[model samples]
Target: MHSSTLFITLTTALGLVSAAPTDKTYNPTKTSAASRTTHTVIAGRGGRLIFDPDNVVAEVGSIVEFHFNPLNHSVVESSFDTPCQPKDADSFFSGFFPVREGQSDEVFQIEVKDTRPIWFYCAQNNNAHCQSGMTGVINQNFDRQEFSLRAHKELAAEVEGPSGVQGGIQGGWRIPNPNPLGGF
Candidate 1:
């Protein structure tokens, strides 16, 4: 290969590696006690298409554990401004988990990269989950009830079909259902 071509390829590879090093992995056992809380969020609990609590506050090193239950549901990252729409293809997404009735074995664990408020929603396509206000946030300082109310209104204007980005950020972990019926 030409020297110039080789140099370009190496530069691009190194840039990708350094862009988000902190997003790679975290050992909770090793993390300080002050930054190691684990917050749980139930998805589709009680057959209702909503994230239980719908709002949370987590520190930079905390873990957000999402438990999927009853029928099918998904977790997709979004922006407070967009509400129901996907923030970007590269953003976090817990693909449709084909959870059995009364069962809740599937869980997705995402580590917080910063203390910034992170917004997300259920991208269930068979119903109007997002429009029904199936959204949530972490580390938000504002009133969640008010934000949820506005999100419902925004979704009412137009509900975009959920984005198809199956994988999420560099450090996010997921246990996807293996059944072919499990929408990946």
Candidate 2:
């Protein structure tokens, strides 16, 4: 009887241990590269002076890749207060991509460092591209009605001239287009 009771107790303890739930907590800091999402934003697609999906909501560790279309265009970081201008020296800029025939062979990729709204615009001023509503935002907080892409565009429209850094910055990578031929 004593041996049976001991065996039953051991079996019950084992069962309880097996029934415990496993830990599946999500930690953003430890996210793997494979788990990160890459969002594609087409710049000047079909000769239009606009970013296809002008606004995107990206999380930390995610990537925003900009593919430049024909007639020369660029991506430059800017602030909400001063739209159509470079935010600061540390801001990211993809040098002008002059694609005359087809999409450029290179693509600008920037990783989302935080959840803050990142505003950007094309530096081309031929016909006032930035002022023509060539602006976009990432992770814009819709709750803040005062600060939005629409407001940014309004401010950009008021700016006399939109400018960018002299060259590319360190926050992003200008890599060869993964699908140059527009393939999957």
User: Top lDDT: which candidate number?
Assistant: 2
What are the lDDT figures for the candidates, one per model?
0.70, 0.86
TM-scores for all candidates?
0.65, 0.78
TM-score of 1: 0.65
Question: Which lDDT tens digits does candidate 1 get at residues 17-54?
Answer: 34546766865666544647778788887888778867
- Stretches off by above 4 angstroms in model 2 are 1-33
C-alpha lDDT (0 to 100) for residue 81 of candidate 2: 94
lDDT of 2 at 122: 91
lDDT of 2 at 15: 80
Q: What is the lDDT of residue 92 in candidate 1?
A: 82
Model 1: lDDT of residue 78 = 78
Q: Which stretches of candidate 1 lie over 4 Å from their true place?
A: 1-35, 143-171, 176-184
